[model samples]
Target: MQSSSKLFPVTLISAELRGDLSEDVYRLKPGNSPDASVELALTRLGRADRETTRGVPVVLIPGSFSNRRFWYSPKSIGLGPYLARAGYDVWIAEMRGHGLSPRNQRYKHNKVSDYVRYDLPAIADFIHEQNPQPVHWMGHSLGGIILAGALGGHYLQQTRVASVVLFGSQVSRIYWPLKVPPVEWGSRLLLKSFSVISGPRLKRGPEDEPIGLALESLRWHGLLGRFGDADKDWWAGLIDVQVPVMAVAAEGDHQDPAWACRKLMEQFGSPLREFLCLGKKQGFSSDFGHVEMLVSKQAQLEVWPLVEQWVRKSPEVAAQLAMQPDRDEASAVSADQA
Candidate 1:
């Protein structure tokens, strides 16, 4: 099952036709983190017609307490499929023990540091090997934060990332109580007592999160705490991140407010970065919440097109957009051309 392609070993778990699009799921067992023994599941969506030219590759990472279904459902109805239908080769990554990726030995001990240090880089390498073009990365919530961690820690080279679009992703949200040592330390102690945070039980999402993630967050939001590990200050390191970035926030999102999301976007040193807030004032039909920002029906009409626009924001795609303001380049643009 080991792929003959260069780099680390990759196991193609399944490859079959799902409706009109072909679905190929690969499991990557990273050799570096032998202690964790985590196997990441990556689901790729592409055109059913193999002869058709493929477009740029886009990787979608879901947030905490979620799975690959966040981007793609069992019915093959989600943004992932939509993007594939539009000629883009789309990949949905399930981190650690989430979704199709089974629980590992250190499931409960998984943290963003692990993802940034090992998983993200592995995914990047595999995708680049599959398609020599630079990949576009899009993350939601914790997924976006993890991408930032990878970039800030210098784990993921900016040159490999074509552009980044983050939906409801930010790390600068302030917890007033977390500023207190007693509260931060006490909270960490309480969280450490549990193995995982139940998403459905807490009405957070569909997947459970490891307690280690909460502990890591506490340290980041703790008194005078920064967004890096023992070796580097990721928060400050973002100042050197030159990747093209965009952060999307929703006004109705009480969990991660717009201001805080904007604050996180401001951390990036990319000159080609933008902050978008979804609300009535911004001409959006409705004020999107954290989850609704990307999932709901409103997003289908208003945001999905915008996402497609951003995905095709490269030199060729931009030229196409400029020429045909009314026509969509999604179906017209070919992989070799765009």
Candidate 2:
């Protein structure tokens, strides 16, 4: 209900072309509930070729303490560019207080709840308004968790979603100590005293995460904790979601294991869902880790091509009535780069 605020206005900050690809940046101001002063940034990558018709849009969301750079590097050589080069419209989202998005008034107290309720829907609405097609969302780690929360809670519009791809993401990570009441409360107390978690200091990533995010996790893994908010049961809602999904986990990923990732995917009700685990057994050259599953040289030669196919061929709605398939959506996606 809180996310149902009036549609926010989007501002085009920059648009440029390099070689044959166009890179456009937009800033959206929600100016609505929970926090009205937050600014969300989206960096869109597509072809600058006027004669080339753009394909379906693919939105990439990064994990905790990370930014748009996860899918895009300053050298223009990540998944975003790869997708763009293949004629797919690519948008990398930088969450509140990260990358191009400046810290908001509620920066210190931000939680995943805020992201699921306020931020993602606005971004989804804006993307749908422009692309006018169900988006294929891909997320890594915390990014994937946010997407799962949005879908399970029914916060983001179902009609705007064509498919979802999650890499190394799961909410089922066990925290045995947090199940104890006193320990949980005490940890919460200590975390409340801090304003934010430093990413660089902990060597997790580049950006600092708000303390509220950690505190929120405590509530989730605490004894008898559920994934929903005040009024809805998100876990139960996942059983009703009909959108197709692809969930990938790595055998070397200790943070979110393949079995746990499978557990998460199994919760979805989509008839056309897939679960993939990357390892030598699965024909991958190596067992990929959490980050390596998406951002490694090995993945470049193997995983990236599969991802492009996942986006291109299927994921159409069952009825195929709401949208027209993207014309000239993809060319051959090259995976030769190391």
Q: Which ten residues in a row have the lowest lDDT in candidate 2?
A: 329-338
- CA RMSD for every model? 6.4, 6.4
Q: Score residue 278 of candidate 2 by CA lDDT.
A: 89
TM-score for candidate 1, please give it: 0.91
As a TM-score, model 2 comes out at: 0.90
lDDT of 1 at 92: 95
| TM-score of each prediction | 0.91, 0.90
RMSD of 2: 6.4
Which regions of candidate 2 fall more than 4 Å away from where they truly are?
1-6, 50-52, 316-338
